[model samples]
Target: MQYGFLYQFFFYLFGVIGVASAITFVTRKNPVAAALWLVNTMFCLAALYIMMDAQFVGAVQVLVYAGAIMVVFLFVVMLLNLGQPSAAADIKGTGARIAAGVAGLVLVAELLVLARQKLPPLLPDLPRGTNITVPITEPLFRQYLLPFELTSILLLVAIVGAVVLAKRRG
Candidate 1:
């Protein structure tokens, strides 16, 4: 299906915004600000997902990543008292910075090479229509039900542990 010029424009717009937000999120010194930037990145991703005809995925991206996950992260950040200046030193040493720069350059090169190459699909294509989640969700809720519940329990345990740590710190 051919989309209009406006649709293409907004798609690229959101993509750019998402990338910029992600960079800002990483470079932010304040953890709170960084988390907020991550939320912006997530919202931009949701927009891109919607534009790409994955409305359900977009909604899940916003609700799960942008909403629920971000809240939990922000909560943890607050509980850990990360907003204040700590005795710990930031990324010091020129050697580490240079290594990080090299790693970033290598990643960029890999991305450019991947962009030029046409990689075969990792999974088989499905029927084109809505209900895209049906295939994955069915297996997830059935075959993978035990693992899914276990993951949720793990997350709950982690949150409880964080709370305990915060209380101990206080």
Candidate 2:
């Protein structure tokens, strides 16, 4: 059907864009550019998650990673006035090239092995409706209550430590 073909096309397109954006995130010299690329990459990943029928995950990916994290990164970059133009650095020296080549080979080998394995099929009778109605915080407070409280306590301690350190004078 036409819909199936369109879905497949978009799936591959978004996947390729995600990978390209990830590479750009790491390779871009400017911090702001890297953060922007990271946001783009997160958006692409959210698209991929939607294609896989995980609507909640996709929305959270955009809301948390792309929106919140990238906003914080951009704000910090702006506050610090990190507007320096990207300088071209030597990235293809022999040692660096060799290390990159080895990493690529390892990744390719892992992919090949995974491709050879047969994945289990999803249940045919499973619900197709996207469950986006439930708020994530509800489960965190109800089911994962203890862990959530502990994490908040840990974060508070970290914030207090940071403030104490910043206030110390010579």
Tens digits of per-residue lDDT, candidate 1, 4-107, equal 89988898899999999999998777888989999999999999987666677889999999999999899888877898645566547999899999999999
Q: Name model 2 segments beyond 4 Å from true.
A: 1-3, 86-97, 124-130, 133-145, 161-170
> Cα deviation of 76 in candidate 1 (Å)?
3.9
Please give each candidate's TM-score: 0.73, 0.76
Q: How far is 99's C-alpha from truth in model 1 (Å)?
A: 1.5
Error of 2 at 169 (Å): 5.1
Q: Write the per-residue lDDT of candidate 2 for residues 18-128, one digit (tens) a residue.
A: 999999888877888888899999999999987776677898899999988789879878877985644667256899889999999999999999999998866442265
Off by over 4 Å in 1: 1-3, 79-91, 119-133
What are the lDDT scores of the predictions, listed in order? 0.86, 0.83
Worst 10 residues of 2 by lDDT: 123-132
Clashing pairs for model 1 are: none
Q: Residue 61 error for model 2, in Å?
A: 1.1
Instruction: Give the Cα error of residue 68 in candidate 2, in Å.
Output: 1.1
